[model samples]
Target: MSTYRLFDRRFIRHLAVLVSATVLCFSAAAQNVLRVATEGTYPPWSFKDAQGQLQGWDVDIANAICEKLKMKCEIAAQDWDGIIPGLLAQKYDAIVASMAITEERKKRVDFTNKYKSTISRFVAHKGTSPDVSPGALKGKTIGVQRGSIQAGYLTANYKDSDVKFYDTPQAAELDLVAGRVDYILGNMVTYYVGFMKRPEAKDFEFIGPNLQGGLLGDGNGIAVRKNSPELLAKLNGALAAIMADGTYDRITAKYFPFKLM
Candidate 1:
């Protein structure tokens, strides 16, 4: 072979290798389709609609963030009890299920910056005593969803109260409305939609100050497996962009009664 032809052939092979490596990197990034886990039962954050389709603020936010990052986002339903375990096992890439960013949770998984704020609030019969404080539930049966922030708050604060934990907020709300429980504590937005604003909720009213900055943590955010900073950074970038462009506020206002931005 001619020396010139040999040189040309070597050049072509080098170019092919470089192009292959570049494509591999991009494929790795593009194939970064994030699998997000959510409590299939949390409403206003995530829940099944009348048609059995998953719908809620968290759903909307997930789709929007996926769109921004050009990721093939799959929102999967996992029980709240198993959500953290699922993420740890790589069953899902992240969680955007309105989970509070508590310090204890921080010890387990890395969370992005706060995307939404929530406070634990309680609902009691309309004519319930105004003096009922978080501490006043002592000996009284208070309802909370199992494995939730509200439960943690009650367990921590009202140790004397008989904490009745339910699997879902809807169940707790039902018992509360039926007078089976003294009160129910959960996310204000969920309580508002699932019980407070309902016709039957006319018999119930929200009580006490909004609980936050403590056991409730500093609001809700997306969570990823510990050490997944690359993925976390990507989500943070998309979230920051959306907030800066007012997309987050628009979504929040559409579903929430007040500004959750």
Candidate 2:
């Protein structure tokens, strides 16, 4: 072969090796990217704005955790019903949605330490002054989001009541406003952010004592796949760090008037 042709061939081989090394580097970097899923319909915790961008307490917290862990992060919006299944399918590395840490869910995915506690309450139209006890609420209509702890609680405790399950909290709240349901049970933070603060919801008031402990699960937690112990631990550590360093508090204060921890 001509000397010039031999030089060109050697240069091409060097370029090919360089391109292969670059591709491998990129693949390794991509592996470090953590994709987190959140139900962007649950406000105060997760929700989308008019512009269709996700923004809420959970979104901020997730970003903070990613910052602390020094990991490349991407947040994906998923419907509430598909969040868990999507996680199991490896569509995302973690679920930062305000998913309660319950025994039933634990069977499907491991959860990190409780990040925030949740309280459920019964909201009803003002002047009704309806009693909140199971016996008192019997024969009355109650709205709750389907597949939620609140739904499970009502189903288990208020079998006599006419319980209506909705796909989203907004739907339940709408039914309550329309007089289709006498009351609705949901997270206090969500109620306040999504409904209570609105002019239309001014007529609705929390009529019952706050519900917690049993059936509500311990608290809200980050859910990871069953086999991701290391990822879980790292997230837990990042959460603790954010809480200790006051990053968590700062984020919470922006969306909530009180501490969630």
Candidate 3:
């Protein structure tokens, strides 16, 4: 072969290999990663550990789902108020933030069947005894996480009460410990396992009946963008696979003493 033609062929071959590798890398990146968002402030459900790594039931479950789907999972913390918006904006592919499904939220997103069902409860300072009757609680200040289902329920039902909103349930619980709010309602498992078990929260106790159903929400599920039905179906299948293969129970027992499903 002539030197010029030989060099030209080698260059073309090298260029073709480079382009092929680049295309494979891009394809693998696009097809292999699953991005998940969680509220790191919500402990036992999802939270950062001492090392700032995301850990908790929701985190574990999300990992299991990704494993079952054979996807590389990336979990990031997002503020609770913006979790839904974050998914819609494509900041992440899904939310495993213990987001309870509600009709209003359904308009904006799709959800998998619940991974864990939780009861809601109202907490108050132990030293304080207040009537939990609707009329009595209506007159007392209530604390709630802003933008939560509990907040919506409280607002709709307790129109006469002073509602103090916090960015996180932990923050609201702190205010209750400080006597800032008469009572606060939230996920029972969150308060029972994450809050009431803490030494600082020794003065707090669950009051009122266990709350759920209606506007308070039935259970927590994974949230995906409304437009992403294929992704949603993949998540749902992965969720089911985890449930049937005993991975779900193993993860639940690692976090909670009781059955969560």
Query: Candidate 2's residue-wise lDDT over 1-261, tens digit each?
Result: 999999999999999999999999997896678899998888878888999999999999999999998888899999888899999998999999999988889999999999999988999988766569999988999999988999989999999999999999999988888889999999988887779988879888988787887788899999999988789889999999999999999998998888886
Pairs in steric clash, model 1: none
TM-score for each predicted model, relative to the true structure: 0.87, 0.88, 0.88
Report clash pairs, candidate 2. none
Whole-model Cα lDDT of every candidate shown, in order: 0.86, 0.91, 0.87
TM-score of 3: 0.88
TM-score of 1: 0.87
Query: Which has the better lDDT: candidate 1, or candidate 2?
Result: 2
- For model 1, the superposed segments whose C-alpha errors exceed 4 Å read 1-30
- When summed lDDT is taken over every stretch of 10 residues in candidate 3, the lowest stretch is 125-134
Report lDDT (Cα) of residue 157, candidate 2: 97
Query: Residue 69 in model 3: shift from native, Å?
Result: 0.8
Distance from true position, residue 243, model 1, in Å?
0.8
